[model samples]
Each structure stands twice: as structure tokens, then as C-alpha cells.
Target: MIAWMMLAQAALLGLLGAGVTVAGIAKVRMNDWILGAAAIATLTLVVQIVASIIAPFTGSGPTGDPFEYWVYLVMAVLIPPAVALWALIDKGRWGVVALGVALMSVGVMVYRMHQIWFVQVF
Candidate 1:
């Protein structure tokens, strides 16, 4: 895993979480800005997933268990879209909270992914 890429993902994901949470607290619902942020974060995550998959073939991979890494990545890719859909359907403050939680989960998962990539076993 590239250091810069890992950091960028974490930062962007963190921003996504913060943005969604703030929107929730303010009782805002679906909007172009919210959708755009989610799109960017989701696109980045999909790109990262592809990169990780190819990394192994390119003689690069996580030091930790591959199965665990892939499972997390796949779930991360799925979550944002799911929550976004739910937000669109609900169209309320609770939907915003759900989006915030989903984005935060993605942020935490991305951090864990970086840890998995760089683990040092004795």
C-alpha cells in the first residue's frame, strides 16, 4: 500500500464522516453537496479496492490476512451506496444520521486497512 494513498483515503473518509454528521445535526436532508461528497469518497474507495486487488499481482499485498482485508474492502464499497439510498428514501434527519454513521464506519475501516497493510509480526 502506498503511504500517500492510505493517508489520502483516511483524510477524505474522515471528511465525509464529518460532513455528513454536521448535516445530520443541522437537520439537513439530501442535497447535491452531500451526494457529491459521498460520490467522491465512494469512488476513491472503489479505486482503492481495484488497486489492492492488482497489488498482489504486482508483487504487493497486505502483510495481514488477505481474506480479512478483502472482506472489509468489499463491505466498505457496499456501505456508502446503501446508506445513500436509504437517505433518499427516508428524507429526514434520521437518514442523515445513518449516512454519517456509514461514512464514519468507512473511515474506521480504511484506517484498519492501512494497519493490515503495514503490520509487523514477530
Candidate 2:
């Protein structure tokens, strides 16, 4: 995985989490803005998947186990949509908070994946 792209993905997710958290604190229900942000985050993960596929060919392959990195990537890709679905179903302020929390979790996951790809030893 490319360092810049990984950092961008984490930053995007962090911002998305903060925005959703603020909306939740204001007691706003799930709305287009939240859903749209989630969609955008999900799409970025898709882009990350594509980047991962191409990165090794360009000589930026993982320093750690490829299987582990891929598992993290696949799981990270699922989070935003899952949280979006949760928000849709719940239609409550807490659901928005949950979405925010999930986004933050995915951000952490992305960082972990970055470590697995480029920073890990042994």
C-alpha cells in the first residue's frame, strides 16, 4: 500500500467520524449528508483496494503478511456501509453516534493495515 493513500484514507475517515459525531450530538437523525459521507468513505476504500492490487506490481508490497493486510483491507471496506445500514435502520441520534464510532474504528483499522503493509517487522 502507498503511504500517502493510506494516510489519506485514515484522515478521511477521521473527518467523517468527527462530522457524524457532531451531528449526533445535535440529535440529528440519519440524513443524506451522513449517508453521502459514508458512501464517499466506502468508495475510498474501494479505491484503496485497487491501489493495493497495483502497489505490489509497482514495488510497494507489504512488509508483513499479505493475507493479514488483505483481511484488514476487506474488513475496513465493509465498515462504512454496515454503519450506514445501521443508521438507516435505527433512525435515531444514537445510531448516528454509532456510525461515527464505526467510522473511527475503521480509521484505526486503516492505520493498522498501514502498519501491517509497511511498518511491521518479522
Candidate 3:
């Protein structure tokens, strides 16, 4: 995994999480911003999937357990859509907050995956 790309993804997730959380706090419902953020986040993770696929060809591989990294990747990729669906179904303020929390959680997970890829070599 590329360190810079991981950092960029983390930054994006952090910003999106904060934005969604603030919107939720302001009593926002399931709107374009929230949905759009979710969509963007999901698409970025899909990009990560592609990057992971190409990493081996580029001579970059996780330093840590590949299984663990993959599990984190898969889980992080799943969160946005799941939360977005929940928000859409509930259409409630707390649902928005939940989506925000999920985004933040995925951010943290991505950071951890970065650590796994770059820091935990053994």
C-alpha cells in the first residue's frame, strides 16, 4: 500500500465524518450531501481495492499479516454503503449521526491498515 494514498484516504474520511456529524447535529435528514459523501467514500474504497490489486505488481506488499489487512480493507469498504442504507431507511437524525460515526470508524480502520502495511513488518 502507498503511504501517501493511505494518508489522503484518511484525510478524506475524517473530513467527511466531521461534515456528516455536524449536519446530523444540525438536524439534517437523509440529503444529497450525506448520500453523496457516502457514495464518494465508497468509491474511494473501491479505488483502494484496485490499488491493492496492483500493489504486488508494483513490488509493494503489506508488511504485516496480509489476512488482517484484507479483513480491514473489506470491512472498511462495507461500512459506508451499510450506513447509507440505514440512513436512507430510517431517515432520522440519529441515523445521520450513525453514518458519521461509521465514516470515522472506517478512517481509523484505514489508518490501522496503513500501519499494518507499512509498520508491522515481521
Which candidate tops lDDT? Answer: 3
Measured by TM-score, the strongest candidate is 3
Considering summed lDDT, which 10 consecutive residues are worst modelled in model 2?
113-122
> Predictions ranked by TM-score, top down?
3, 2, 1
Tell me the lDDT of candidate 2. 0.89
Q: Rate the local accuracy (lDDT) of all candidates.
A: 0.84, 0.89, 0.91
In candidate 3, what are the lDDT values of residues 81-117, reduced to their tens digit? Answer: 9999999999989999999989988999988888888
Please provide, for model 1 over 37-96, each residue's C-alpha lDDT reduced to its tens digit, 9 standing for 90 to 100.
Answer: 778878999889878978888877778888888888889899998898888889998888
Residues 69-117 of candidate 2: C-alpha lDDT, one tens digit per residue? 8999899898889888989999999999999988888889998898888
Residue pairs in collision within model 2: none
lDDT at 117 for candidate 3? 87
What would the C-alpha RMSD of candidate 3 be, to one decimal place? 1.4
Error of 1 at 42 (Å): 1.1
- For candidate 1, the per-residue lDDT at 81 reads 88
| Reference-based lDDT, residue 121, model 2 | 49
TM-score of model number 2 = 0.94
Question: Which of candidates 1 and 2 is the stronger one according to TM-score?
Answer: 2
